[model samples]
Target: MTDLPHYTEYDTRLAAYAVIRDDDGRVLLALWNEGDQPRWTLPGGGVELAETVEEGAVREVLEETGYDVRLDGLLGVDSFVFSPAQRSNGSERPLKAVRVVFAATVTGGELTPEVGGTTDEARWFPLDEVRGLPRVSLVDVALGYLAAG
Candidate 1:
């Protein structure tokens, strides 16, 4: 028998996010505090194994921002691959992030910061001011989708 080369195994993370805008042209955002430099991002997170993407989006938003949201429509999908060196956890294998974005509207609940979670605070920012704030690339991606429509 011939010998074969070994291949590294990688992990893929599937997450869901929402782009929520009010009538006042303000967008809802959450502060992702898991890294050394916290940055603003859409209010959502990883999809649980047992839940659908839509259900996960709603659950994450409620958990992070204390808001009940109704997904209006599908925005788009964003995918990125992180090399081992770029991963925060320093895993040997590359990681593929598949994010599902959706257009959402607030149904109820008040703005509240997430407790003991990856996100620390949630707030609304005027669309014009959002460009000046520190934020993750996903924020820009989601905004681009909104602008396209």
Candidate 2:
């Protein structure tokens, strides 16, 4: 007789993000050094334990972009599932991510880079020019909601 181990485990992650823009139609973005290449993405990160989604978005924005923002409202929600190779065992693990997006306005603070973090720098980019830059999928999804409303 042959014996096989069977188990199914998935990680459910919750994250929050913001779509922030300026009067000149420039959108704020953060440079994330994730893999072999860095990409620009909306400012946000994983929701912390005991923190509301809105509060998480606000905190992540400040941590990644050094910008204090006032959240205008909830934009939308996005969810997806993917399998990533586990570094420890070389096995594939399913990750389901649920993201909450919000529209925000910059209240104060200067543009600065996050130190020793997933994000390296933060800057404003022209909306028209964003499509040409390397960016995360969340950027477009968030912008779609903002444009529709």
Name the runs in model 1 displaced over 4 angstroms. Answer: 1-8
Worst 10 residues of 2 by lDDT: 82-91
User: Cα lDDT for residue 115, model 1?
Assistant: 98
RMSD of 1: 3.8
Task: Report backbone clashes per prediction.
Answer: 0, 0
What value does the lDDT take at residue 1 in candidate 2?
Answer: 65
Look at candidate 1 and give me any clashing residue pairs: none
Candidate 1 lDDT over 116-141, as tens digits, reads 99999999999999999999999999
**What tens-digit string does per-residue lDDT give for candidate 2 at 1-149?**
67522334766789999999999989999998874589999999899999999999999999999999999999999997655653223436767789999999999998889999989999999999999999888888888888898
Overall local distance difference test of candidate 2: 0.88
Q: Which pairs of residues collide in model 2?
A: none
